[model samples]
Target: MRRQRPIRLQHGTSLHAIVLATAMTFSGASALQAREAGSAETSDTQVRLPENAEIQLAPVLVEGQERSAGQYTATVFTGAEIEDLGLFNSEDVLRMTPGVNINSSGGTNLSSVFIRGVGSMYLSDVTDFMVPMVIDGAPINARHISLGTLDVDRMEILKGPQGTLSGPWGLAGAVDITTRKPTRTFEGYGRAEYGEQGQALLEAAIGGPLTDTLSGRLAVRYSQSEHWVTNDADGAPMANPSNFALRGQIFWDGKQGTTALVTVEHEDVNALPNLLVLMPYGRKPSVDLTPGLYDDVGKSLNRYALEVNHDLASSRITSISSYMNASNMEIAAYDRKIMQAQSGYPSEFWNQDNGRESFFTQDLRLSSLPGDTITWAAGLFFQHMDASYDTPRNTYGYTSPRFRDFKSNVYAIYGDVTYPVTSALRLTLGLRQNWSSTDYDASFWRGGVGSFDSRAMSESATTGRAMLSYDLTPGTVLHARYARGFAPGGYNMYAAQIADGEPFGGATNDMIEIGFASESEDKTFALTGAAYVNWVSNNHLLAYDSGTYVSSVVNADTRSQGFELQGRWRVGGGLELAAGLSYVDARITSSVFGPSDGDILSGNLVPDVSPWSALVSASYETALPPFLGLSSPMLKSIASYSYVGPRPANPQNSLDLAAYHKLDIHVGVAQDKTEIYVRASNLLDDMYDLYGYAVPAANMAYGGMARGRTFVAGISHRF
Candidate 1:
């Protein structure tokens, strides 16, 4: 885990004296290392962990190859770990990582993936994510990062600001997911599952050789579930979810040291989770919704991509081209009683939104090959996006419609170089130059207010990072870094007036991080600790009007500081212990507060973020009896405990969520290619808020709590 600077670890220049550095370099590949430790040919400068180690670090990709094990900064999950943990989506996997938290406002909006207590914090139909999620060398909005994950080879979550190499929406960091490629040998697998509330899932995949130099893989998954909270309005299951996805990939191993891959994918999702229960007062939790209301949302996506990697005498060249399209529709209801701490009259309103978006991106890069003393990678990137939105609403029996045509373009050059100062010391420098433009035209009826068109917004920013790493011992390392990240600002189409869009400004963040990673000589113990601080200005924040049910975007200044510690221990026998802790202090440093608009004050904790989070998990494996009638039978079990501190629910500090903890246990029995397991969720049956917000003037706090106590049984097999 990586964290803000602890002020104790420094090299050369004073940590606080870190200037706007230049020439930071990187070539990421997080695959496991088969070579001995301290090998110069190793692409991963982090820790080289043993196979049985507990915690995983982010991958370091060098010359199209992956190197795994520990990174002083970042986290990683290999394909095997994904299956073992039964991780199905971004939330599932990220929950196990330290210093990462997932918060949602509920609905079709994408969940905010917060790192070190910093995130977009608010989600609406038209909002864009501040973090970049890379899939198969293609950069898309953080949309699919939480949608689904299938046939993935590895996942790497780099903490803090990763603006230099992966440039789009780098205000936070980056999440890179590499899908499994077709192999020369035939291999396939199937899985089926059933859970509480009529939950069911089916998934399958197959890949094999199609020709002497070509191979193909195809995978599909379908899942559906009933809402945990029943809708008393119509005695129906509201917030039900149904999702389907398909992917086909082809890989070619051609001429001398050359490889190419092509991928096509499609996905459809339907669900809107803004459902809330009816709890009139300080009574017991009543899991029933208001009368005459429901939530519905649908999203569809299609993606096509091509990637080529060619090896040169001393370097590797990569070219990637990708195009994707997505469409979303949402018809959801809002309750005026939301966040009402005291019982009051029930008020209801509903709105609908329909939109389509398309994105095209191209990237070319050259990097050092293995065995090179100096590691470096440079790339040129270009991206174009076109989107259209149609939002029609009916609040208090009044009709309002809004339309927007939006376009965005980006161009950039970024590179990183890593040089070993000596056999035990290293310095890295990375730099990125980016230019972006956003244009949008809006047409609408803002109820009593008039509508207007949007203005053009263009901005240029230079981002870079400098890292200094020194070996404390052969198995220990200390590192400190300085990084800057940026995101272009744009019009908030959902705004009621043109003033909110005419001269919007972008957001920028600068950070300093220091941490260390250490491994036991015998490769049985590993630990990582980090600390970091961020300085941000002109950042977008969610502004809501409880009366109009309109959510706006406003610019604000904030500061976030945090620290993390994670470790793994492999005791004797087949038992392992893993634990991690994170603490973030995020607050609004300065902002123009408005009573009816943003409605937030300085010194308030950023809404929806918890200051303290912790995780503890244990795993064990043992042989099964011969009476099972299967060869090499094994039984495995894992138990996890997570704790989240109380968090402010809204900007006004009117609503606060109580502290909560969740315990889960999973046990499985395996024989050859097949495994059967049962998982218990929320073993403690703890009920807590999923999303919360303050009413315009309700002066009361209210929100929905997650369902308690559920179980799922599943079977997986590989063929």
Candidate 2:
């Protein structure tokens, strides 16, 4: 892991010129619909209220949703239901939300993403990195997006500590994505799918009217799968020959109001698999150990964005600009006795790795357009980043050469205001000011293991937020919030192996949230609940050495509490349901080694947290009229179930982890354009292991293997 390059935050555009002239005069307002003459009756409605009444909500809309760790934020899957769940990235739709967690070592290569439990394991620099990653609307820099799950039109996961409007590193949450625009009529769509072990996929999209003011959209996707780890170390069967994506967009409706939008994207990924440990702890998994499998890992990413909108009358102006570049080269190696037995895993080392990232972002906003009882918004944000990490340790037998540089720059100014005072109470205020600078450089092996410099360091902070909402009626809502979020600190390249030699610092947090929500009507039953607590300071931890697993990055202080519940239901007619639940109580209250320090490793437990997690979904759709070739619409069915618990991979938590479950099924058939599909994931052949590690006596177990149930089919067509 290595990075060093950052300094960006560009804001200008006459302060978003009244939201780019009110998005060019409302850009047709999606076809300006407001005719209620004889009730032509379209679709889309909500209002049920009765789960103990007193709710008045509706004033939150973005793309992408599922955020709760205190500060309520919800949108629960959309973007065409996350591309119909044929997930290929973005941790497979953020592991189904609620508390979020993902640690991988599968055929898709190696994956990592965690929330609530805090992530960036075994240190090497990457302390929450503000968790900011925005596509479509810019802002993306976190070592060139190791996050996946593409083909989106929505994905908003804005949990706690978002630092007023997504600034200040977003603290511990922020995953917003929106892709799918540019449509002037001539619509189009396509899809081809196949599932089980030899997964395959193809996707397409088209736009319309390239004139009348300009409008365009293009999308492409291709995927492949195989490799279920039948290697036995070298028996053959490690697949992932391809995965690709290409996207394009164009929109301009200029005239006096003005509006311009542009976007571009590309992605390529290839992989071999490894890491499926799960022995005693989770009970089953770990078919056979294959030390250091994953012979190849490649990643490529490039993105561009430009947005401008202006509309003044009561206020509305927006501006966003972005750029991203990413690179990954990994040739792995494992099995140091499967990580020295375990007990804190981390063995000597092996390598041939190179990671690079480049990012830039700009955001500007001005708001007002929903009543006048007092509502406001102000914004300015900038980011710049450049990263690098190179590893080397072996050759002749294959590979070595290491280097790392981490550079950064961020600037921000934010504002928020809301007031109602009586009509059922409502008051919200927010503020944010952040300035940061960091520079880190390192060189080794090919560079003769000689360089290491830090020098440049600058930090400024200011954050605030207050909330209170009570609207006991028009739906239902009860909310309470008090906020102070922070996460910005860096420098840790293993922090000199456990801090002894001292070299690693940066970490912070403080948050509080309370919530409640309810809904009915077309939304079919909705409920939300929240409870949270967190206080972390200078907490950049990653100790270890007990059995000599070799790990370091210290600066400890921690506290966490949690509760969250998300929902959606229909349960009738064609059936529809969605659910999420999470509970956590992370600990270590105070550390630098205290609470009876066992070799200075306190209360333990907190490695890859998972106090509890859950998800359940059911779907169904039907339409048939035209016959044979299916002139118009047709079949759709989906099923899902996921559960995770039992976590403790280290921190001397003794040993824990023994809960797992998964089941997925999908079936599709459509018309009016084209479609075809089939899927079955981990059905019954339920041997599981999400991830694990061990060292010392050399214990190794990584399992979550299920390529056992397989079958596939595909087809697609469009204008």
Candidate 3:
């Protein structure tokens, strides 16, 4: 029924040990960048940075006095840079970045981002991922990244287990997206774009001061696109997709150190599963089938947030509260093809998912100010999440409906302290005590198991981090860190047992990392590199039997060891060159599942992980020469080539997707605040298996793919 699983079925589904672990430090990241939101934790290892940097993606938080300047570089990227790169969506922000990537997951509303080969691949309402996404000061759905960046200030990505800094997620890593806040002075922005595949987009934002003490901002984005694929058999247009987002915010900077921010956002998305393609993805890939009563996938989300803080002479007090509600619906042919059926319209095998989700979180903390010699921050965090979904199937007319209801709560006390032991050496320590519990109920009308409320699952865990940083120079730093990662245990709602539901075990990572950052004296050249390994225990995986069309979830031990190198050089004459490389070796070490899978699946490469990834790019911006007899206008061009190595497609490791390269180029001419540009993604039009699976019994194969070779021209202006 599903490849990313969250679907009704799939035949399903790492570890290392350790003395020393790795903790990600984003200029002293606590709970990823969540610490940047309200906690004032500081480390001298990082120097203040400029706004436009590429390392700023992943799950992070940006707000409050706790937020520090760019350091530990490449962890931050500005909205203007995002626009310059032609990276419009949340998915592109991470996937296109170095040291991080996302596996194939176009068939569902959820996709996971992998950091150094450690991340959750399959996701559902009842399941939690290794990484989490945060916006402003509040935690929100990871999928909201689809909302685009028309109103964004910056994005921050933190790698490694970050449980010691926050709660509920971040067993692997975290990403934070900070939206643009109202400025003291009035400002406005507008952008419009049209492209291939019959697509159009519009974005607008206006913000300014409303009063002496209050400022407000409004932003909106809308996009629509026609069929990206054609039904081979009937030549019918299909796979239409659309998106819309609206946001409003108010910021207050009051007297006596008090400040507050209130935000509201709504986003809607509709898309066809990208998996509706033939598996082999031959030279001329096509669906090859027709006439199915299947519907597309849809999602809606609403979010509300409030943040308040009081700055003290030496310390700061902060509070953040957030609430989110989202709905997901899917009614599609699981097989992605039309087959002869007994009834009219051939509707017997379509799958339906009516899933709903809600999340609420609150964090309060007190900490020394940002520049304190021994900076420290501590906070209390709490969260409650509720999810319920109904999966129904129809055999011509008879329906077999399965329902699942799930609930979870988390409580945590986290703190971090940074101090300098020597003039050139800095040390940071952090700890978090997390308490969590879960309860779930399941129903299978077709299996005769009416409804079963299983036993509740609960546990307590302690995660911690330690790091040492040395200044190679003011612009250069070398660091080492150890961290313990954790994610809560939860029910595999889709593949759970009907009678005695079993919840997958929580996952943990003991990671150790050593890295260095350096730059030239002129600030025109920069370089960063790191090496690390993650030992994952109880990694949740999927196990599917092509013969039975059934799937189950299991836990296994695995390990991922990798390294990354990134560099940038701003050469003379309006030329900038940049490059990045990353490599990971992820392998399963143990197997525990017995029924659908057993010892046979052990010693396999982790599925959906690319072991080698690299990219190189060049950007040039120069003024037009007077020979044209025109006033000064700028000519800009950016080009990059990326290579992603192959990996196994499934838990069984029976098939491996081939390696492929992607090329992107952008060109624009501009003067003043207006720009007209054309950007081409995947210019090579290379087609390779993004995901691959087979039904041995039917002698059939299936997979998903990216939209290859598309061109878009756009104009943007600001005042």
**Considering lDDT, which of the candidate structures 1 and 2 is the better prediction for this target?**
1
Worst 10 residues of 1 by lDDT: 20-29
State residue 106's C-alpha deviation in candidate 3, in Å. 1.4
lDDT string for model 2 (1-719, tens) is: 11111111111123243343333222211100111011112123332222321111111122111111113354335554455445556666676665766655553324445567654444345334645555655655333334455556556666666655433345556566666787779876777776666677877888887898999988888777766654344555544557788888899988667788888888877774444333442322233334334546677777888888887888768788887777766654443334444534644343456677777878887766444556666788888887766554443332324455778887888887767787777778788988877786664343334534444566777877788877676556677776666656666543222123244455656677777676664456666777777676665655555343335556666676888876655554444555667888776655354212133244555666778877665555556578776666666556556666767654445444455555555566766445566666644444445555443233333334334445566665656
Model 2 lDDT, full chain set: 0.56
Q: Write the per-residue lDDT of candidate 1 for residues 130-234, one digit (tens) a residue.
A: 666778767776645546788887776767666454334467776777788899989989989998877788999999999999999999999888766655456
- Candidate 2 vs candidate 3, TM-score winner: 3
Candidate 3 TM-score to native: 0.87
Q: 1-719 in candidate 3: lDDT tens per residue?
A: 11221111122100111001111111111111212322334432222222322122112212111212212223554575566566667776776666666765464464666777777655633547576777786765454445566687767677777744444347777776778988898988898889998778899999999999999999999887765556665766456778788999999999779999999998877764545454555555556433443245778888999989999988898898999998877654443352321112422244566788899999888877766678777889999989887676544443467778888998999987778888778888888888889988777775544655565899888888888888778767788888888887787666434642677778888989888876667666667788888999988776665434455567888889988887665555555555678889888888554434223255778877888987666656666764344455666666656667777766666556666666666677765566678888767676545566644334445666666678899997777
For candidate 1, the per-residue lDDT at 175 reads 71
Alpha-carbon TM-score of each model against the true structure: 0.86, 0.31, 0.87
Looking at candidate 1, what is the lDDT of residue 297? 74
